[model samples]
Target: MRYSYQIVVPAATYAPWLRDNEFLTLFKQVKKNSLVNFYQAYELWSLVEQLEKVNGDVLEVGVWRGSSSIVMGSKLKQLCSEKHVYACDTFEGVVKSDASRDNFYKGGEHRDTSQAFVAQLVEAAGLTNVTLLKGVFPEETGHCIESRQFSLCHIDVDTYISARQVMDWVWQRLSAGGVIIFNDFGFPMTQGITALVNEYRRDSDKMVIHNLNGNGILVKVKV
Candidate 1:
């Protein structure tokens, strides 16, 4: 039997962006504001486009500089879809980071960002479909969008607890076939996220996809 979850480092060289000028242009524009690398950003872009017909809004729990959020928003705009991207962040840094379940994060990490900074980045991208929610998320600002259904939820919170909370909060609201992508998965520095994603590998209703680009994608397979 195949392993439920494992790492995949592709030996083949495949770069689709070289032939797709549009994605490359987008990567160049958002490179400065995002910590997400090109492979992850490409996946985000492609996934948003793939789910363009899925009925629901989008959610991003960790809006470090709004780069990945912008990627999704831009893709939505290109498709001329009306889906809105709800971007949440503490703007104060990482919270709910427990050292027992986490590595490399204590608290107050990624605090170099502010709501205003992300706002400007969003504006410069000309994304009118993005909304910024400044807080710790789900507990602090999740109620603002309590009634919203999400087609895509991006969890970059890093810590095991923080990532777990965000995942728990979004799971119910996530529509069937919706996806949750963990940003720091597969990285040694973010063993917490890796652990959290691994714990869900046994779930029946979800399909866990391990991306070589350090992303963990969970797709809801059951309605």
Candidate 2:
């Protein structure tokens, strides 16, 4: 799997100047209700904007209240118009967590959402290229996008089990020059995420890891 593919990590690119104002405006509209801070929000928005380096779709594994989805989908509309963004989640919080590693979260913790609610947010953002797949990760909804390829996959599911499963599901299908952003990696409350990325690093030698805000980025170095 490692030698069969290659990943082109573009020299850190910048978002279009015009999109800066758009990002700030869109981010502020949802920041107060979002789980991520400004720095992290900007990082996600900027990274998605940089996906112009690759030609493929995008995926956000966890969509809490649809804030990140709104941020990414809005930018993707202008940046990667042909690449649809897939927002996959249970829409009922997380599934069973690894109690041994995951101390703060349990199953059903962030269950304050529904597909209808997220759909409303996407619609309100005027983003027509976003698809919200509601279900358990990989197992339940993975097949929904079975044969699709992705340029970027954001794994923010907040669990060791879910993150590992998402990584397994996403790695092969991710395109050359693609990136996998792991949210909450360095976060104290979500040490499980950190552990999960470390495990991947130990097993895979072809990935280039980057740290930004509280996220862990894995850029595939070989296809």
Candidate 3:
């Protein structure tokens, strides 16, 4: 009935980001614009590499400062991939946070950003692969991208209802080998996300992976 908390220290000694000069250089510029930690950012950086052969574009539902979008866009640019990154946000903060399902977030918690701010960040990164969609995702902004399919979706809404809505909406649009990474699944304040991710564990059409860096990775198995 309640969520448990624990610190995860990955046993593996591998540190690929340290050796990745390009990633380091790019992350350094976006670090100040992001709330995502170093480990998680590195994970995002690495995950982009896996989508080389997958069809469809990338989708990010919580573009606070455009850091994650830029990171993925930078990778896609490097790979010379034609895939685009649809970065959606309310530009007004979080929404649909239920007090019963969510512990801390009461909506409008991360309003320290604006569309103009993130746009400038994206422009400064020299990333043209990212398209900023400003509105409530899968609601006001969903129709604009309804025709497109997604290879990877990064959900960081930080509430059970919002996360659930995004998963439900993006499910039909996700390619067979597509991946969905839920950000905010490990923190205590984000217990709602943890609860939401667990609700998806027993499904046959997809597989859920719990990562140490607070990401709930969902892989679609059935096309």
lDDT of each: 0.89, 0.81, 0.89
Q: Name the lDDT of candidate 2.
A: 0.81
lDDT of 3 at 10: 71
Stretch of 10 with least lDDT, candidate 1: 1-10
Q: What's the candidate order when arranged by decreasing TM-score?
A: 3, 1, 2
RMSD after CA superposition, every candidate: 3.1, 6.9, 1.1
Instruction: Give lDDT tens digits, candidate 3, residues 47-101.
Output: 8888777889999999898888899999989988899999999989999989999
Which residue pairs come into collision in candidate 2? Answer: 4-223, 5-222, 5-223, 6-222, 6-223
Best prediction by TM-score = 3
Q: How far off is model 1, as Cα RMSD?
A: 3.1
Between candidates 2 and 3, the lDDT winner:
3
The Cα error of candidate 3 at residue 110, in Å, is: 0.8
Supply every candidate's count of residue pairs whose N, Cα or C atoms clash at under 3 angstroms: 0, 5, 0
Q: What's the TM-score of every candidate structure?
A: 0.94, 0.87, 0.97
Distance from true position, residue 142, model 2, in Å? 1.0
Model 1, 6-47: lDDT tens digits are: 556688988876887888999998897778989999999999
Candidate 3: which stretches are off by over 4 Å?
none
